[model samples]
Target: NGKEIPYDPSALRKIREHPCYSENASHKFGRMHLAVAPDCNIQCNYCIRDFDCVNENRPGVCSSVLSPEEAIVLVREVMSKDSYVKVIGSDIFPISHPSGTIVKSKDSYIKVIGIAGPGDPLANDVTFETLRMLKEEFPVPLKCLSTNGLMLPEYIDLLDEYGVSNITVTCNAIDPAIGEKIYSYVEWEGEKLHGRKAAERLLAQQMKGIEMAVEHKMAVKINTVLIPGINDHHVVDVAKKMGEMGVYTFNIIPVIPLYKFADIIPPTLSDKKAMHDACAPFVRQMRHCERCRADAIGKLGKDVQEEIYRNRGSL
Candidate 1:
């Protein structure tokens, strides 16, 4: 798995620094995901945002949505590793000291600032505002965004302009028929489409967007939700196509099984491993995805929410 880095020296350097892309770096470098975007353009059947910040660890969920200004302030605090008493919107974080005082240390420093929203970032205008503000205040941390790629092509320039070099796109299927089964609907240019139409439109944009991001020399990563009856069998195809497009990494995340797809059984660890192994031959595979929340902070295993909330009494 370590042998297939398709990127040039510069891109490989960025990948090595990224916590999510590089398993070895995750233990040392930390990343913070700001939940600033709350509106999505594409509705995947397996995704549900009914519970935004509910102490659950998963994607499409957050403690709260912050404005551009608030996001900047949060990033500043995280980078400074200051003692945060209480923060905005649901007391955003419980940091540093016990009794809700955040302990600041070198270990808690956030190296990467990203927005993997409770919704699609490209669909929300505040994403740009937040990125612009972050770029101004925090110039060091690598910037990234997670999206369904519905609006990727439209916002690629904006993302690049704001120093966003890392991108993760959730593409469940390369085939429209299979995609239709995974997504309920998609919105393009103020038009709402469903079924095969929505699937095809989203797929076309995903391919084009990945190609554009690659051509721009941005480190592109593909995140595929392995739906057993839906696209599990086709994830390898997804990886192969994305590899041909020059994507840097492929992460086959097991479906969380929620919303319209709730009744479906979640993929077993073995199933994930099988898919992971199958896709490894095509592109570099990521093995350390925590399915992080939109407001996640700290390293891969020591995130703020998981550390503070899950182990509050002990701390």
Candidate 2:
């Protein structure tokens, strides 16, 4: 082990309360997501990365973009009214693109920190800065992000430097061949291309990322999107590899029908369960996934519906 990356103490406390906190929660952590960047570096066949806007109803699906200064104000205002607020990535850093989602806040209890955006945080330097700035100015106890691991080697050091212990890297395919089948094309450096080359490139990046996280002593987790016939078989390989790489947990999320990808079939109950079974031999699987909205507030589970009626707050 390199240096022991300390876990977020406060995060551990609120994790139970977050709707999406546990792997067995019927709801997601009632955190707020925001899109600091409207653009993205890479395009996945099944994603409309720019859909994170607050004005939208799809909680946990997307958050609206805002400037750094604007984000600060938004955080302050949200804090003034609500007791909990989380900052999720809606193309906020990790893309390594010039565009950034920077939020500087001094608030001590902003709740769980998250950064699952439309883009890959490893690809963007600004993403690291945003986190670093938060670590310095904010009393953020739980710092989290959802990344594609495109630039893991480049940013793993930064992750450790910023003391980020909780993280989720979306690994759709462990095999490049399967990856090519799932991703149509990627937009890199103003160039549009697809096929095996793209898949290979992405896989290589993510694999290395897993290694670095372990070496840095950071708790690692894997998020695999289970596309029906695409990478189902290879998902097992994904689990084994992540487990060997020291991944602490794994979340096998079924494909959500949305945007242009809406036409794509959603994962059947059996399919989702099968994927969970596949990963069961390796890491722990999140069992009670409610598939809550991107900006969902309050608790998870069907029993909590009545609570949704009780609470009318913005995420």
Candidate 3:
């Protein structure tokens, strides 16, 4: 029996090693997120930075922050312990540098180097510096970043320059009115903006930044938090626009009731499925997102941050 399955080479290449982007690779590939960035430029109602627990899986939650050097060491340690942690390239296994430092190769275990925040990666200068250092030192792995999109427009060029091919922007609402209810405030150029004005500004920046990322040929994924009464109804609209902008995927995550939106109920499974069905025709829907922690490590659903932290002797 012979059957030919047509495939887009570029698309296949894009999702080959990134587990977050490819459902198939999710079981085979692992990712390491460096919590180097600790400052956020915007505030979403569903986010609570004060809560930190090993069981909690959400943005803005990380066990600890590490310097660029420490982050590199952590990656090396993880790869040294596991052979499956692979980065991009043809070489198999990591080699030691002349200075006794571990040099990562194409065949290492950690395939992806992601900067996914204890906060928005673009908001902190440390994030750029860390990425630059990683780019210079370990150029084999796939570099990825996630942000709130407030500062994304200004940094899109820099990110592309640094060889960052994958970007995730959390866009809870396409409409400013709905966004206003979701985001408490946004700090732009050092000024605090509140209410509808803040939401409008954030939405504009998110859309513009997404457009720029798509123009740069970056694999863009929009993360929409589905708060039942807030932006649930507006997700289809967001997906439609994202499709128009050529975004690769849309991750519609059910809102975790917390912080300012504690009283609001999370969307039921049926409701979530209904939204995905509605938006299925517009863009690719991500049904497997774990709403991972900022310091999340290892495979998609089975996180190994605890083991890594224990082996490293600290949080």
Candidate 4:
């Protein structure tokens, strides 16, 4: 009788429907990410927003930016053409029976709409407006967003009011010393912070945000980039802290060697496995992350902007 019970049935349904949360749902449901937020508040060493490389498939790469109205139109078009069509012909052409009947085939539909950034979603106002509009117009889809966690504490109440149940916060290190090595600077409350000062402020906000998200009864996921010689040694500590705060899942992703981190090698598969094993006792691990692009669409590994382009033809 001491076991914790979920108060919201809708939350359970959302978890089940989200491919990122359930492995079985990955094959059944699809997701669409709109690249509405194109500005970032923090400067991560591994991130390079200036150049676009086709070989890379991680975040901060988007084909183009869309206004809120353009994004809404795109979502509507995607929802409309997500299925296949079949036409049947009748020989008699009677008054009661139509000459032909058009039937649509069942196909994977976009059940989740997320803004995963060309930059941090919370850094841009368009992200909030876009989500608010989606909540008002199309309430069936589950709403989610990923952030750097700098602005998360201030935005949690608004996110809850907008019906965003899923939130992901990227926490690289619990220790500010290690965090300083990863992040170059952060824009906080109109002030620019650098080095250890930035790292300390970021960690404090991230911890506060995770706690507040749990307090609001929102499903929270922690995304940690495993950078060797950096935050790699500290992931388990981050996991332990998150587990105590009631985080839903821990996603330990290998850092994409880019920009300032180009010299740092990516983690080996064995290293990833070891990290997962170490954290397994404390929190559930998400092993199927695709490290999707900002404008990623369709299923996990099968995400393609071409599908969205095809839908845009209708608009």
**How does each model score on lDDT?**
0.77, 0.57, 0.77, 0.78
Task: Put down candidate 1 lDDT per residue, 1-315, tens digits, no spaces.
Answer: 568857363346467678887887786677888878888887778767764421113744436777888777666655663333223232334454345443333523455788887778888899999998888877778898888888889888888999998899988899999999988889877899999999999999998899999988888888888888888779999999988888988887787778898899989999899888998889989888877788888777666755543433321
* CA deviation > 4 Å runs, candidate 4: 1-11, 51-61, 81-104, 310-315
Q: Provide the TM-score for each candidate, comma-separated.
A: 0.86, 0.71, 0.86, 0.86
Q: How accurate is candidate 2 locally (lDDT)?
A: 0.57
- Model 1 regions more than 4 Å off: 1-13, 52-62, 81-104, 306-315
Clashes of 4: 0
Local accuracy of candidate 3 as per-residue lDDT tens digits, 1-315? 588877453465456788878887676677788888777788888877663211124645445888878887877677564333333242222222133333443334457889987877888898888888888877878898888899889999999888898899888888898999988999987799999999999999999999999998888888887888787778899999999999888887887788888899788888888999999999988887877777778777666676557655674
TM-score of 4: 0.86
Q: Please identify which of the two predictions, 2 or 4, would achieve the higher lDDT against the true structure.
A: 4
Tens-place lDDT digits, model 2, residues 221-311: 6777777666777888888888877776777777765654577787888888877887899876666655443333333432221232234
Candidate 1: give the clashing pairs: 95-102, 96-102, 96-103, 97-101, 97-102, 97-103
By TM-score, rank the candidates, best first.
4, 3, 1, 2
Q: Which stretches of model 3 miss by more than 4 angstroms?
A: 1-12, 51-61, 81-107
> Model 4, 212-286: lDDT tens per residue?
998987788889889999887789999998998898888888888888899999998889989999999998888
10 residues in a row with least lDDT, candidate 3: 90-99
Displacement of the residue 64 alpha carbon in candidate 3, Å: 0.7
